[model samples]
Target: MADMQKALRARILGAGIVPRVIWGRKVPQGTALPYLQLFAVSDPRPGHLKGYNGGRTTRVQADCKAESYAEAKAMSDALVPLLAAPATVDGIKFGHTKAEGPQDLGEDTAAGFVHRMSLDLLVWHSSV
Candidate 1:
């Protein structure tokens, strides 16, 4: 749901690592450095056929951008732990979140060096 995504964004922002966080796409033009870009790639509902009630698995991507690779990796390091733990955000009870790849993207002419990480979250809510 949209609320889940918003909550996730809020959680990322609350970490206080990056100053800017944008969803659905990359940072906007004229945005400052040391920003984060979040994307909700997929949400597969009814995670399991046996328990086809109120659970879903979402694949999310968090891209950390900075002037240098070290900064980018540091930001990502902070983020990985936050996402890995189970937490409740905006009424959505998120279970364990598994992450993969601080895949080095090397550099970007516009966005600077990038480190992209993928997170798979198991989320569930009673009213869903």
Candidate 2:
């Protein structure tokens, strides 16, 4: 699972897309940007969380700058391989979901970045 997260993060940052700083702010070139928190949900085991269903959340921030729509797509494209990759352990499946709430890129003056992402996993042991 950790590998999957790392891979996803690397993929996104490697895309070379720089995001605009909110509404219309200019971000300095060559400036180091903080990573975005990436979330992941793990499959639930039987009796674990008792009837809560299969769900988990993990977040990892990445550093990158988005300057165009294609750049955004490059970031978005990283999601697929991450979701496709299965958990290291057996009887566990995982996938990624988009974040919820408002987004401010890198500004917290008002509310900063407010994205809540979730992943759904199925536990094979549940069938037992």
Candidate 3:
């Protein structure tokens, strides 16, 4: 099975909207403005019959951070379409992505303004 989280990070980075894309619980120290941070919320395998292959649905939160709300919104706006487009990342075929935000996360004392988006992606890949 592919590491879906890494695949997601690659996809976003390849989009070229931001210079920095981090995939982990904590953002990198001294990171510049206009970067993306992705964290996996959950990955649950659905029920399947015998001898059947089942894929996992992953829920992820993508945070676009910048010095201001406008910049964060712009980054997020560009991100949505990129994620929505159909493509395969690191051999992981993406079935689809459902987005739930561009929600204003307000000011971050350390990182400045933050805008968040949630994505529920249907990932289909062979089981290991």
Best by TM-score: 3
User: Candidate 1 — which pairs collide?
Assistant: none
Using Cα atoms with residue i matched to residue i, what is each candidate's TM-score against the true structure?
0.80, 0.30, 0.80
Candidate 3 weakest ten by summed lDDT: 119-128
lDDT of 1 by residue, 1-128 (tens): 77887787787788798787788774577876678777778777764657666757777777777777788888888887787777777777777677777787656565444444333333333333
lDDT by residue (1-128, candidate 2, tens digit) is 44444444444445443332211134344433322333333433334545644444443333223333344344434444443444332233334433332222433333233222222222121110
- lDDT at residue 2 of model 2 (Cα atoms): 47
lDDT of 1 at 84: 73
Highest-scoring model, lDDT: 1
lDDT of 3 by residue, 1-128 (tens): 33777777788788788888888777767777778887777766666666445566577778887777677788878877777776777767676576777677766565444544433334343333
User: How far off is residue 27 in model 1, in Å?
Assistant: 2.5
* lDDT (CA) per prediction: 0.70, 0.35, 0.68
| Cα RMSD, model 3 | 2.9
Candidate 2 Cα misplacement greater than 4 A, ranges: 1-35, 39-65, 87-128
